[model samples]
Target: MAGRKITKKVVKFLKLYYFFLFNIFKLNYVLNKQYKIIFLLLIPNKHNTPPTQAFKKLLNVQIVLNIYIKEHLGGVIHELFYSRNS
Candidate 1:
């Protein structure tokens, strides 16, 4: 139906827009760690309840762990985390 076609077009447009936004945010984060906008790419929505909120908190924890491991334990961390096997 026509509605289905319109919905597909809208979804495609949103996907492309988000891709562009992701690149901009990525460049900004790479240029300055203090920006922290990269986290926005990870956390898609804002919610204060269980499940979603807990997932967001866990993501933040993982981010901290990744940074700590990369900076403080750079040499000891596994190759899987550091570099591509190829």
Candidate 2:
């Protein structure tokens, strides 16, 4: 139980910390393409890899997609990723 509590805290901090990091990397790596292309190209790859690695690779894209999807899919954005959840 104590370990679970500590893990939750760490995950939360990592989420806030890494979100901006992913955006920065996205701007660095994901620039100048239409969101359609990005969405099509990257999401499959994101799905294939393990979560920890995919988190690093796909975090920014996920954030961007959430902007579009949250309009239609409702709470999926909240449920789709691992973040600091208590």
Report how far off residue 77 is in candidate 1 (Å): 11
Q: Could you give candidate 1's per-residue lDDT for residues 1-86 as a string of tens digits?
A: 98986686567556655665666556545634543455545655656556667556656765775575446433533343335423
Q: Quick one: best TM-score, which candidate?
A: 1
For model 2, how does the per-residue alpha-carbon lDDT over 1-86 read when each residue is reduced to its tens digit? 99988787678657755665666556544442455466557655555667666455556675666565435433433444434352
Looking at candidate 1, the ten consecutive residues that score lowest on lDDT are: 73-82
Off by over 4 Å in 1: 1-48, 74-86
Q: Cα deviation in Å at residue 26, candidate 2?
A: 11
lDDT (Cα, 0-100) at 30 in candidate 2:
46
Minimum summed lDDT over a 10-residue window in model 2 is located at 73-82
TM-score of 1: 0.29
Q: Global lDDT of each model? A: 0.55, 0.56
